[model samples]
Target: MGFLYQLGINLAALLLPVSRFFSPKMKLFVDGRKQSFAVLENQIDKNQEYIWFHVASLGEYEQGLPVMEEIKAQYPEYKLLLTFFSPSGFEIRKNNKIADITIYLPLDTKQNVKRFLDIVQPKMVFFIKYEFWPNYLYELKNRNIPTYLISGIFRKNQLFFKWYGGFYRKALQSFDHFFVQNDASAQLLKSIDFNNSTVNGDTRFDRVAQIVERAQPLDFIADFKNNTTTIVIGSSWVDDEAIYLPYLNNSENVKLIIAPHNIKEEEITRLISKIDKKTVRFTNYKTEELKNADVFIIDTIGILTQIYAYADIGYVGGAFKTGLHNILEPATYGTPVVIGPKYSKFQEAKDLVALGSCLVVHNTEELSITFNRLITDADYRNELGIKNLEFVLKNKNATKVIMDFIERNI
Candidate 1:
């Protein structure tokens, strides 16, 4: 199975140019590879010890960030090489100041992986969440470079737990240690006779905690909100918009800042057309005019984190679909969160709901009712918000735990 996987990877690399022509994202990957090696060489010298962190996309990047910052603080002598498997992560964060170098991980063919390892020669490697490339793992193990998986989660349905997934299981066993998100993941790994794991929770908790302590007031937003309650709709998808449209139309004395997942012009145009209340795109509004618009559509990227700081209530999107966006960002700000019904897979989401910090709704009507209750019932809102904030505060320091383990072992 491992051999076949490797063969497929090699085939993919060989045909990547063809794939690039068909897919927009693959084109970015091809373009990214052009400078990857140069970027690596620029930061990594033969004398310097380098640590490599690989994340699949933006969400995993956030999960791995606290640990990355810790490693930099503790081991200032070590160079950092950060790699992303997806363009969404690499493109947005390629110029991140913290990492000595940032680039897309080369295709996991034997040749590409060998070249990548040879150039950087990382002292240690960390894989965040779900990005496990078997060839990359095999090569790392062969080189005796320590590797760890941070904030990992597992399910019984994964290949590692299947009858014909011995190679996948072996690939996972290559990790020196696994700092998983919950006990379920630890137990699942142990079921397969893999025991070098710890339930350290998600490092994202630590990230969010740090965000809260350093939370700066958004003056522009504060002025816009004036004394009115504000609902922050974060990372909203089309499905989320359907449920939120009614609220936007009927609600008054409540400001709304909608930060959609895709802020392309077409999407923004469609949003403006559907909204019944006074609506303005963030890009178009001047500071003076911003105070009057009931709906502020965030037509740009990178402000979602800070926007949460101004939220009285938060509605995180992607729950309507199978995978969900980050809910902890808003929860860390001490805001009650509302989402669709598909949150069972996320341990934090389930825990938040149990702690009374979140409301789960299955459809538009339920969502409307929940929104009205959270807004009208001040005491209820404060109670839920306090619980959520406390939950975030308690779960911090995950990065410290993982870093301590890695520092000693490496």
Candidate 2:
């Protein structure tokens, strides 16, 4: 399996150059990796002590950020080397302030891993969530680097839990500590005799809680909101929009803010065509236009977290399509959240649903009904909002769990 994994990654590395022409995202994956070795060689200073943080994409980056930021603040002597395996994470956060340098993780083959580790020479390492490259993990273990898995989740179905997964299970031993999100994950590790783990909760709760603490008010959102029951539509997909747009178009005395998943001009234009009410785009929104508009579309990124703070109710999208967007972001701000039906897999989503803090709507009518109930009953809406807030509060300090160990060890 290890040999097969090696071959698979090498094949992927080889094909990346040819496959890049087929898609823009593929191009980014290929092109960004091409520059990674150069970026490290040029920027990474040999004298400075460095700690590494690796995330698969934007979501894991958010999950890992509180710990990264705290390390940056408290341990300024150690520089951060942030790496992303996906283009979506790297492109958006390459110039992020938290890390001294950011780059795509070079394809996980033996040669690349050796070269990367040689150049990086990190004092400690962190891998967010669950992208476990066998060669990298084994090499880090060989080097005796204290590698950690933060906000990690494991299930019975994963490779590590299978009888045929001995090669992959060995990779799990590379981590000096496993600051996992739940008991099931810890139990899974324990079942494999890898008990160097803890049920530390999800770091995202900590990240969002901190956002609510220090988030600056976006004046435009406040002015557009006009103190009404504003329903924030975050990271919406087409299917999600289909469920909510009818309620938006016909409803009054409530404002609509749509932060679609794709902000591409074509997607935004198509979305605008469906909305029968006055709409304004965040990029080109005029004060008068924004004030009068019933729908405000966020055609940009990075500010979505802050926007959740002003939401009376939040409809976090993607559950109807690929997956759910971050409901915790709005929920942390004491906003009642509504998501689509396909949320049984995510633990946080399932917990919120069971607690009646997060509403799940299967169809357009269900969405409308959910929105109407929240809009009509302030007490009920606030109650759900309070529950969501309490959930976020209760689950926070995962970062502290990680940092406490790091401090004692460092």
Backbone clashes in candidate 2 total: 1
Q: Report the Cα lDDT for residue 117, model 2.
A: 94
Candidate 2 structure, TM-score to reference:
0.98
Candidates in order have lDDT scores of: 0.88, 0.91
Per-candidate Cα RMSD to the true structure, in Å, reads: 1.5, 1.1
lDDT, residue 287, model 2: 88
lDDT of 2 at 34: 91
Q: Candidate 1's error at 284, in angstroms?
A: 2.0
For residue 226, give model 1's deviation from the true position in Å: 1.4
> Which pairs of residues collide in candidate 1?
none
**Candidate 1 lDDT over residue span 248-333, tens digit each:** 89887788989998888899999889999888777878888877889888888777888898899999999887778999999998
- Can you give the TM-score per candidate against the true fold? 0.96, 0.98
